[model samples]
Target chain A: MAIATDARPQRTTTVPRRKRVRRTKGQKAFAVFNYAMFAIFALICAYPFYYLIINSVSANNLSALGDVRFWPIGFHLSNYGQVFQLQGLTLATAVSVARTVLGTAGTVLVSAFLGFMFTQERMWGRAFWYRFTVITMYFSAGLIPVFLIIKGLGLTNNFWVYVIPYLVQPFNIILVKTFVESMPRSLQEAAEIDGANILQVFFRVYLPNMTPILATVAIFSAVAQWNMFQDTLIYITDQSLYTLQYLLYMFINQANSLATAAQNAAGGSLSSIASAATSQTSTSIQMTVAVVVVLPIIFIYPLFQRFFVKGIMLGAVKG
Target chain B: MTTQAVLQEAASSNLVREQENTLKRGSRKRVGGKPNGKKSIGMFLCILPFLVLIFVFSYLPLYGWIFSLYDYQPALGLQGSAFVGFQWFEMLVSSPTQMAQILQVLANTLAMSFLGIATSILPLIFAVFLNEVKAPWFRNIVQTLTTLPNFISWVLVYMIAFSLFSSSGLVNSVLTDSGIITTPVKFLDSGDHVWITMLLWSLWKGLGWGAIIYLAAITGIDPALYESARIDGAGRFQLMRFITIPQLMPTYVVLLMLSVANLLNNGMDQYYVFQNAFNMQHIQVLDLYVYNVGLTGNNLSLATAIGMLKSLISVILLLTVNLIAKRARGTSII
Candidate 1:
């Protein structure tokens, strides 16, 4: 439906174009100025990541001294090694990865299913169910109540707890519904004429047409799950079940141990090295942990970026 | 016409009408079928997973609020817990020490959230400006850059703030080296600066992602509107002010309502990352207060009570705003 509205204006504009209007000299200069401003803004945004990545790889003293190095002063994997050396890094990383994958898959599946059901022409009480889901989207049961509920269920430290609670996201359901609602009713009419049942029409016919929106929802859910830190922080009491973000939290809070550890870990006096190793005063280790936690998001960003662009247009074009 | 032929035509027409009626009735019945017997079983099966989640995590725990009336202890394990109805609330609300702390935390949270919104509004405007440019590639690149920060976790954000603004960090180093100031400012640890820095950190994280929706709405405005305005001698500023802003109002209203509804949600994780004892007074929010009392302080009942109060108030506020929007402007958020 949203796409139809968006296409409506473009459809009218595609007639043979009028001759280009002559631009004033000021307009040409202003366009150049706009281009320059945009380029500078882009550079400022990208520079921080460049700086962070370069600094994360630097050797001990360089990391602590906060040198303005655009390139790595002394590159080594030891910082990453130090990050993984944190008590529960491996388990936490694994748990977070598993939860995110399953959680995204589960949320997309349920939301898509509900969306399809809501769009069914013959589905009874469709409006009631639609309004119920919308209310849930807008009115949460509150965080404390949610936490209390999690505790009462004995899922405080349980593995299934993480994915189960967020298996269905209401906002995603609404977005998918909007997409399905806008689909041509003629398609469903054709399927009915061919003796297709409602379930068959939905699964075999409509779902295939829903690929783009499904991809959009999948990406949104996955990104949200990947960045989920708050729930795990509150509910997961056991340190072993910590997610990547929580592990990073531990490192950030323990910043005093971070500075000298980086310096000595790179190379230092025996006493300093002993103090760094035993005292664990290395910032490099925390930097390493930060790097590990952030790497996946950085790499896969461009792929998801496309879907986000498409998704943003879907909502507004309708209204 | 033969009498037999006329009779045959009438019979066939009647048969066609009967089939149409049956099909219509069948669809209506299926759509409105009651959930009972075999159909009830199917409905239950269809909704089993959602039910399990809602029961285990939402409904059951609502019953668990009974503990808030007790001095809950792990040794007592809820059953053996001592009942202390309104005692914790009294201690919190009546006592000067706890009451003052709570008020301060509330004040801090409000200031942080308000300041964060004020600071981010400019970036949103900038995003609108960027959207007006006809260069697609440039717009995409700029947008990607701004949104990249949003994806970085709060932990990384904290690290960046410390590295840039710490006493020994870049900002202070430049200040001292350039003789702009004789001493390095304590950007992270100073009590007065914490709220401001906290808001800045949030703005930095959310600037790009926040603006994306507004920009999308802006782009949705018909290009013909701009053409009309241009023909009418409307300059860019006038066009934006009169046409674009008005068109974007509904989207803005919805976004504003969401932001206001989420006012109490100060994002405990970001503040938690940035907090130190030195600036604790300035940085504490209601959510943080609950975390301290409930999780770290191990005063489970008190924490739950506080959380319950906050949630109730926030929900009330949300509903009130939503109702006002619906009644006054005909824009219902739900």
Candidate 2:
């Protein structure tokens, strides 16, 4: 829907060119200025990632001295290799990937199912249950109380803490429901008329048609699950359960001790891989971990950006 | 949030009408015969697990609110602890020190939220100008880059901040080497302009993403409005001033109200990651205060009380905003 509308304006713009108003110098200048400003702003937004990436790959002392500005100096993957060498780094990365996959899968599946189910009037107490679930969006149980509930449920140190509690996300359901409603109902009816039950109709007809909205939900869930650090901060005390993002959080905040401990864990052998002038320092390690944490989002968001624009438009209109 | 979209959808009678239309169309065509009891039950069974999960995570957690009524010793457990029945609430106002601390935190939260609300127009302006850009490719690249930061975690944001502003960081080195200052400026660590700094960081992250909704609103405006205005010889600026801003005003107003309703919920993650001893006094907002008091300070009951109040007050504000929106715009925000 959003892409179609976006395309309309582009189509409209071309028609104005055939008219008698030849391109004026003032308009040309304004366009140039606007394009330049946007380019500068884009650079500002992107430079930090470039800066971090360059510094992470740069010689350690040069990076720490801040001499690697604008570009990498004595570039190498030693920091990245050493970042993985930090004790618990592998475990945290595994935990982060596992939770992101499981959490996003659970959220998308349930949201899609609930979204489809809500449209089925045959479900018992459909409206009541729909509102009951959606109303949770309006309020929260508060941080401490929710923490206690997680504790009481014995999920405080459990990996499922990352997945289960977030599975029934209300907004994704609404997005799917709205998207499904917007779709033509003929296919769904055909399936139903072919003697398919609600479950079969949902999976075969509605689910396939709902792909765009589901992709949007998947991106939201994945980014959230990947970036979430607070739940780990509060709920999980187990070392093995530390998420990669949380581990990065600790490394950044704790500054000296935890990172050097990681360095020590990397120990003399990994340090021996580099000369003294370019050995991986704490700052380089922090940057490397940050790059690691952000790379997935940087790659994933752009691919689904168009789909989410549609999702956001659906949400904005509904709002 | 993903949930905010759902919350908006919840109040939409559009879904109900659409479902009704589909149902009536179906029955009229005999596409689906009246679903048997078995089929209906099977449909219900499919969603039954989700209903249970919602109850457990959403409703069951409310039972933990009872801890606010007690001293809430984790070691002794809730049953063993003495019921304090609003004592924590009383202490929130009764003790001078606690009152001062709570006031400071509340002040920080409101200050940041107001700053946020104040700059809410940035996105609208951005979208307006962005729409003027005839180059679609440039627009997408700019949008993609600017929106990138919003998707990253705040901890990663802190990493960016640290890399740019730490004593040995790039910004400081650039400035000091150029003899702009004798000493490197303490950009991240300083307590001064903390609210403004936090607001700027948030804007840097959210401005482009926020503009997306307005951009959608902009697109929804009838192209005929622009065509007619162009035929009238209205300049680009004039068309924008007359048509674009006016069309976007309602969306801007509604979002502003929603932001106002969320005044107490300056989420803690950014504050948490940025906090240091130097900035602790100024940076502690309500949500951060709740986290610190509960987990770090180990005063779970007090934190629970504060959290409960924040939730209650936020819900009240939302309803109030909805009422005001209904009166002003003839539509409820909820």
Candidate 3:
């Protein structure tokens, strides 16, 4: 239904030519200025990542970094090697990957299932249950209580803390419910006519047809799980349970403290201070860790970009 | 009638037929509802686990808010602890130091959130301009690259900031080596213009992602309006100014009002990572302050009391915004 309205807008292509014909020299200059501004804005948006990648593989010394402007200076892979060799990097990466996959999959399944259930006409107490979950979207018990509850449940220092608390995200449930409601009712009725049970109709009929919205919500859940660090900070005290983001956070803090220490020791002998700073984690290693954390999302983003845009559009239009 | 109007009429009629069919089917189901007891049980069973999870995770925490009334201790537990009868609430208002801290935290939260709302229009402008980009591949690349940062963790963003803004980092080193300044400028922890700095960081992370919704809104606008405006001698800028901006106004206003309602909900991730000894005084927003007071300081009752107040204010804000939206637009998000 939304696509029909959206498609109506693109049918009137005669406007472009008419608008172009009316453009004067000053208007043309304005167009050029618009392009220039966007170009600069795009550069500003993209340069940090570019700088990160360049510095990550660049030689890990102050002298090598001094003249570096747009690209690597004396490029080497030593920083990445150092990043990989950092204690707990592999374990943290594993934990991150596992949580993202499991948490996203579990959340998508449960949210979609509940969403499907809520849209049923004959479901018992549908209004009450729907409102019960949806109201949590506006008001929550606040942080301390939620933390105490999670602690009370003994999820602290547990991996399930990442997955279980987020398994039934009410916002995603609403998104899925909206998507399912927009689907033609005949799809479900036809499956019912074919002797499919509710579960079969849901799994075989609705789930397949829900790929676009499901993919969108999956990307959302995946991003949330991957980027989460606050839960680890609040719930997990053990170093072994730290996700990659938290590990990188710790590394950044460690590096900052090292720098601060070096600054404070600046009044000491130059030779001792220089050696102490050199022994600390280099700027290149920190950037390399950042590149490591960010690269997966960059690699996977394009694959899901189309559905992602559609999902956002669907949400905005519905709202 | 115009073709578009005819199509819309046909769509609405079809929807009416669908609704009628569903109503008839619903009546049939109501007549046979008692006989479908087994099936209803199965369906209820399917949703039972989710209901349990919600009750446990979401509703249970609301009950846990009673911890604020008691001097909560882990060993004694809420049951064992003495009920102080609004002592924490009393302390929040009566204690001068606590009142000062609350005021500061509230200021930081409102400042950051208002700054965020003020800059929200940038995304609309960005979407308008980005829609005008003629090259598909270039626009796509820029959009993809820009939105990619929104998915990145704040921890990584802080790392990026460290690389650029640290004392021995690239920006400072380059400036010093070129004789721009003798002493390195502390960008990260200087606590100067922290509001603007955080706002800029937020814009960098979210501007493109935020623009996606406006761009979507733009796509929904009927092109025939543009066609008519252009044939009447509207230039590109004129078309955008008169047609596009006005079309996008409702969405902009709704979003702006919603952000105002969410003034206290600045998540602690970015500020948490960026915060240190030097900048904590300035950067600790309400959410982070709650976390610090509760977990870091081990003052659970005080944290819970402050958190309860924040939540109450947020609920009020949400209801007020929803009421305004309903009065103005005849729709509430709820």
> Best lDDT goes to which candidate?
2
* Model 2 chain B poorest 10 in a row by lDDT: B1-10
Candidate order (lDDT): 2, 3, 1
* Clash pairs (backbone) in predicted model 3: none
DockQ computed for model 2 against the true two-chain complex using alpha carbons: 0.53
**Can you give the lDDT of residue A243 in candidate 3?**
94
Please list all clashing residue pairs in model 1, or write none if there are none: A1-A182, A60-A262, A257-A281, A257-A282, A258-A282, A258-A283, A259-A283, A261-A281, A261-A282
Better of 1 and 2 by DockQ: 2
Candidate 2 TM-score restricted to chain A: 0.89
lDDT digits (tens) for residues A14-104 of candidate 2? 4555355666899889889888888888898999999999988888888886778878888788777777878889999999999999999
Question: What lDDT does candidate 1 reach at residue A219?
Answer: 79
Select the stronger candidate by DockQ from 1 and 3.
3
Best prediction by DockQ: 2
DockQ per model, Cα: 0.30, 0.53, 0.40
| lDDT value, residue B301 of candidate 3 | 89
Q: List residue ranges in candidate 2 displaced over 4 A.
A: A1-29, A184-189, A266-273, B1-39
Residue-wise lDDT of candidate 3 within A48-92, one digit each (tens)?
A: 888888766655564234445677766666555445555678799
Q: Candidate 1 on A67-124: residue-level lDDT in tens?
A: 6447887665555655554557788889879988998888887877777776553444
Report lDDT (Cα) of residue A297, candidate 3: 87
User: Each prediction's TM-score against the native?
Assistant: 0.82, 0.93, 0.89
Find the 10 residues in a row with the least total lDDT in model 2 chain A.
A1-10
